[model samples]
Target chain A: MIDNPYYSHEFHGDYELVSIGRLDLEEGGSIPDCRLAYTTFGTLNEARDNAVLVTTWFSGTHQIWRDQYIGDGHALDPAKYFVVVVDQIGSGLSTSPHNASGDNAAISMSKFPHVRIGDDVVAQERLLREHLGIETLHAVVGGSMGAQQTYEWAVRFPEKVKRAAPIAGTAQVTPHDVLFSRSLVEAITSDPGFAGGEYTSNAEVVAGLERHARIWAVMGFSTEFWKQEVWRALEFDSKEAFLEGFLQPYFTVMDPNDLICMAWKWQRGDVARHTGGDLDAALGRITARTFVMPISEDMFFPPRDCRAEQERIKNSEFRVVDDVLGHLGLFAVAPTYMPQIDAHLGELLDGPA
Target chain B: MIDNPYYSHEFHGDYELVSIGRLDLEEGGSIPDCRLAYTTFGTLNEARDNAVLVTTWFSGTHQIWRDQYIGDGHALDPAKYFVVVVDQIGSGLSTSPHNASGDNAAISMSKFPHVRIGDDVVAQERLLREHLGIETLHAVVGGSMGAQQTYEWAVRFPEKVKRAAPIAGTAQVTPHDVLFSRSLVEAITSDPGFAGGEYTSNAEVVAGLERHARIWAVMGFSTEFWKQEVWRALEFDSKEAFLEGFLQPYFTVMDPNDLICMAWKWQRGDVARHTGGDLDAALGRITARTFVMPISEDMFFPPRDCRAEQERIKNSEFRVVDDVLGHLGLFAVAPTYMPQIDAHLGELLDGPA
Candidate 1:
């Protein structure tokens, strides 16, 4: 395990490497002895009936969603709920570009196995069932990319989950989102040093990766944010100072390989495939009570998209979070929206529909 | 004049090197006989009563708005008005980093002549009265960067212009716009080949500049645009083909030097003295019956910002143009908006209020 001294005691989670036998990739391929990185907080209880699966946003680790909402008296309170946080495939902690099982890890787009968000849900299911002996889940909660995983879980295992909260996410990535995410992936893979993703000796494409991060940052924030929150208050001694202070920090936080893989996965997200291309039909398969929270300024999965998903699901509630934070608002300004998220969780966790 | 064989017309526009006489730099400094590139369309009537000054957008040549709007029966029609287009100082066509009159362009943050949008208006006023025998303008019109010029005209030459139409723009760029533009300039100037803007070899940061263009293309268009208009329909036989077909085309349209200068000008855009620090007081100077037409999906200048400007100007009218085209909508889909802009121009051109 990687040592992190700054690790907070606020999240006393347990980590484990579970062998899930093999990964059956979408390209008619498979990888044997696939090990997954996962963490669990709270207690499973005697009946193994209180498990809540938590997912994370893009560039987030299992530590992310776990720390924010898993303590006592919180929505996924460790005192009562057994919360499982699985690092999704392609996220550095899990099966990822940085840690391929074999030489194939360095494979190019043509050779790399196609792993969808559904594959992530499938792999997580195996970990839960085989390792934890949990046959049912009280809920699945996640935001952004993790929210996507939550949507996949509801459709993929209708009876397994009793409730779900897919916050600030969508049922399908709109064509525009697909374009943006794909461009990010292209930025990484197309760099000359990429060498078909097999140039292990060359330094990674820091420039391309930084470009991707910069583009992502633009989409993540609302125009009003920079205008009102930042702008006037911030001044740099030089233009270079401004970029180093504001731009480079975001790039440093992300790993290039992981960014490429996850962006591809995000673009491939589609709940309709689980129900044979009928989105409404896929939503119908969701037996869980769902709270679909859409941020007011999230242009990607806007309130309109959330309302559509809510309309399709029989037991779904559409709660539009009003904030200028845009898509990142759910996390960056979580404190403002958490109360509303918790209130709905309280209603669902209290009783059956 | 650069010859264009495609149109089969020798570009008859006259190019002149004008001495702005001098610039008393913003930081209590001065530069003398500052040269600038300028071009004029239409005949300056004997009375010089029909002179209409047109301002160019960021990276825009004296063409586009010059050819598009300065013709017969159009708004700012040269048939009734002598049209003048001023190339911003830093552009390659003018006395910039590319071709300074004496020493290299004063680019030092301190040596950098703090030329605001108001400065451009003031400079053009000097050129007009001294060289063209024109003391007043029938109107001043611009889009994007040119819109900044239009705003400056109202602020600096409020009595000189009878009317003004600033399209798809705002009175002030949002902080996000400033940051993004600043980032692009950094990308260009940071290239190792830049050598403090004096390198003889090709720019080392050419790739970064290309990346900047790609990012700008994405930002300037609406989400629906990438989805429906551009990327979706593009089918490439290979990744290399896709990059060339889609990506390279965008970077090719704008030159790196031009892009750098335009972006710098954009960051420096302020109708009033940024140093003076009283934004509202400066906005109070616009006396023209201004028509501010902001496109709803314009990522650069949202309609709400236009509304804010309208509220600030004493004699301004606000018109919101809704289109999925974003910032480019006013330029690309000009037909829908042109009629409305022309209607407003009709009232202004008919006479002064």
Candidate 2:
């Protein structure tokens, strides 16, 4: 549905955008006419107890969930359960900085209100209860920034989520991660072509986006992944070819303002705010059967950090996706990557809730 | 001696700048009137064999060597062997992009020719042989990029160095490290104020330099360093204070063009070029009693990478500096930091050469 070159990307799955009315933000602002872009995979049952909510990560949409995670034979088999994949706010498919129009036109570009993980949960809560007439989610699952939202869901509305799986993300963002997020933000704003977020198109801010992609390439992949040249497995002839062919193309299509906006939210994603900085108390509220899954090689949210939070949760299991792709193994993966992830999600869903 | 505010910081040590004169670069160019900034400690013995060469790392100088590594009772004791600290060519104190003059003005700023690690070794070789009338060195020691030079010195001129130590650096740069170096270069160049390396002052490209510093803060320091708030030990009240007071100040004063020039060289530092990509054959030429020292937590040059190179050398030990400071430990230290480093050098000095 997105036609603007500023946010060009291939997201061809059928989705519907529903208005959630005027939704207020956690950071002292509100989206005038907030919207949620989502798509459902299966039919909702009479009791509506067979529904699952899959959230998207930074710069991702429901399309990726359909392509990589959802299928007939997968753990999240669409035929057996109602699979609702919702695009996170600021994602191009949703009402983002580049796509705001009509009554919401005033908040276009850099004028968009800052969004938080809690704001996203509230928005999705409205989308499901008001639009789809579903009061409870049978399961909630996501990775990276999506994982942050999954944690927020379990802690903020404990009774709503029956099962939760947050992969490659910590409940409280680390100081090291805050600086890492800050660096990504700096990379965009410092580019001359950014022009204070008034640039005409993605091409105008290509250099800044390129720098952003370079940072992601460094931290998203593990040391051994690069040292061993894993990109060759994906048909990239050389490191330079992989960089030029793979990383840059995905980002050059994205809007700079949207990326920095998401980065700002990502850095401040600490669920501990729910219980006055007491992380133990915040995690103790999670009634959902939880699986704290961290990729063993992920530098952003290492397994040790994930395990610390898992230990604090009353009934959470610490699971790991042993992939050298690190934080980014969710996509561009080997044949076994999806199965390794699905096996855990399957166990979580197939178990007692 | 480097008083130009564009490339300014505290360097109070008295150094003599000598003209090496028309040093043709390995990367197919030349510093028309090449000069090296150097400072010497103690007297060279009458045998002309008690000379020790200490090289500087990226963005470092002889002043750092004078302050942290050398002392009367230290392993590099001024009361014993003559210690010569030479600033690497692209460093501000040496013949860098910001300070090129006389006949070399044509290659100033972006016009500066790309420098190689082999180029630095050749420049130092000339300084010791042509300027000081020294034929052989008692030892050659350095950290980080200086470590690359140490490896180059031992491999290129096997008979010149008696003992060699390369700390937190690899003889052949890894592909992962090449991307890291590229990101740093892109950080500086992408800044609008850089103006294609024609910035009037360091202040003009401050944002870019700040980006450079942020990347270093992420990778130069270990993850546990930020997680445990290690900066508190150095009297930094907060993470913000540590960033503002420690990292930013050091880089914001440096010339962007000069930093990128060094980074370009750092990425291409492969001694394996001597034997056409054969690293084992290249490292096998080291006849010096060698110690390949790697900081246990250094993300830049991990111990595994250093150990791989050490295993190939004729007579070498894999020494681990079990410190948490990571790559930047070369400058910041605890009480035992120097003694631990001194112990290694002392044992190497006392052993058979």
Candidate 3:
């Protein structure tokens, strides 16, 4: 494993890894000795019924979910239910391009196999069934790329997930989102220091990482969010300072190749891929009672797109998160919409299973 | 002068350069022997009453106006008016970082002076009065940055401009727009080949330029435009092909330093700078009969922002171009909304001045 602080995975709280041995990718490739990193909070009751699965977003670790959402009286309360926050592969903590081993030892940087949200769900299924001795999850929920995984779980193993909540993400990636993901990948690969994905250190791709962060700054938030100078509330004296201090530095710690791997999967996220490109049919297959939570001002995945997919899901209910932070409200500024999110999630977890 | 075909200026038809000789900038800088590049079509009436001034947008030359809108039966028809199209400073054909001379010889690349839209208008005014021998313009018309210059001309010299049409551009840059411009500039400067603005050739920054193009692909058009795959009309088989053939190649020919200079100007675009930061007061200063045309689907300059400013102008009318190409419909896909634009400009130019 890479020992570099910048490239290696670090985490807080208690976590475990489940090796699935050989895992097959959606786009024709295999990673052997594949492993998934996950953290558990609270306790699995004697009946093992109160379990909730949380997935990580692009460039995020399970620690973020634990820090932001897993607490007493929070939307993802660890006291009421056992919470399993799983880090999707390509996230540093998992068997990403930075840490793949054994038969997957050849997979590094550009050589990493393409991963899809469905592939992630399949691995998570094995982790839950064989490793955790869990037969069913009370709910599967997350936002952004995590939300994409939530949809995959709901659609792929409907009976396994009784409830699902997908926030700030869509079942099928829109062309606009595909372009956004493509630009992020291009930003990293275009860096001359990237050296065609064979870079020695993260410092070599710092400029590209910074540019990628800037792209997120424009697309991740709403126009009203910037006009209101919301960064000031975060103690940033100026927009430039916010970018340099928060956005740029956030990406600088992650591996660029890992980001690319995840971004490619993000672009290919489509539940319809399994159902012969029939989106309605794919969404129709979801048996879980779902809460489709889309940020009201999210430019990337607008409410209209989410609501359309929600309408197609038979047992789903659409819930709009009323916040101007756009897609980022799910992570960056959660306090603004936490109450509503908590109410919806509380109802899903507490209501009849 | 740089002899590289990729970096040198090229123009169509006939154009002239008027030397203003030591033009002072709004942001505390001056370029000695400053010159404005312009081209005129049709005859200047004996009374010089039919002269119209058209300004160029970012990275555009007078040739764009000629190819897109200036023709018989067009919005900017030259048969009834003498149309003079002026290339904005920092545009390759005009005095910019790539071409600035004299005491400002060192003002190349990142050292280029910050040029405002108002600075461009002031130089254009000199070109009109001293060289073209025109006292008043029948109308000031343009789209995008050209539109910004149109507003600058009307507000800065209300008496000289009898009519104005600013399309897909605001009188002042919004915070959202400022961030977009900042991201574009960052994309270029962050390239390793950029070398802090000391690149040997445009080839050195090709990767950055390609990334820059990718950013535009995401922002230049609306979601509907992409959903509909509008690039197919231009014979592009796929979005990637379109980006490779058109968008990437479009910016590759222009000097990266010139783009940075233009983007800096774009970010600081605020007509309110002269009115003590009161946008309403600055807009109210326009005595010209104005038509504020904003693209209906434009994410950057939405109709609401343009209409808000238009409402403050005494004798201005607000018009929306109902098209899905977003900000780019004004240039790349004019057929979708050209009829309405033609009608509006026809009435503006024909109406009593």
Give the top-scoring candidate (lDDT).
2
Q: Which of candidates 2 and 3 is the stronger one according to lDDT?
A: 2
Candidate 3 C-alpha lDDT tens digits along B1-353: 23346423343556787787788898887777687778888999999989999988887788778887889988677788999998888887778777655655767656787888888988888888988899999999988888889999888999999999998998988888888877777777777888887787778888778778778878888877787788898899998899899989988877888898888888888899889999888988899999999999887887878988899999988888898888888774746678888888888888865
Model 3 clash pairs are none
Better of 1 and 2 by lDDT: 2
A133-235: candidate 3 lDDT, tens digit per residue: 7889999998999989998888788888899999889999888899988877777887788888778877888988887887888888887778778888889
Model 1 per-residue lDDT tens digits across residues B1-353: 11112111143255777787776644445546566667777799888778777777776557566556556677667677788888776554555444443543454221345455666666778888988888988888778888988888777777897778888877776666776675456555545455564444333445655555555555667776654554333465543354567555544433355456567667877765632756687778888888788877787588877787788888877877666768866454445656666666666666664
| lDDT, model 3 | 0.84
Q: Give stretches of model 3 more than 4 Å off.
A: A4-11, A45-47, A101-104, A108-110, A332-334, A351-353, B4-11, B100-111, B195-200, B332-334, B351-353
lDDT values, one for every candidate = 0.68, 0.86, 0.84
Q: What DockQ number belongs to candidate 2?
A: 0.74
In model 2, state the lDDT of residue B189: 84
Q: Where does model 3 sit among the CAPRI classes?
A: medium
Q: Which of candidates 1 and 2 reaches a greater TM-score?
A: 2
Model 1 Cα lDDT, one tens digit per residue, A253-282 = 445666677887898788998767899898
Q: Clashing residue pairs, candidate 2?
A: none
Ranking by DockQ: 2, 3, 1
TM (chain A), candidate 2: 0.97
Lowest lDDT block of 10, candidate 3 chain A? A1-10
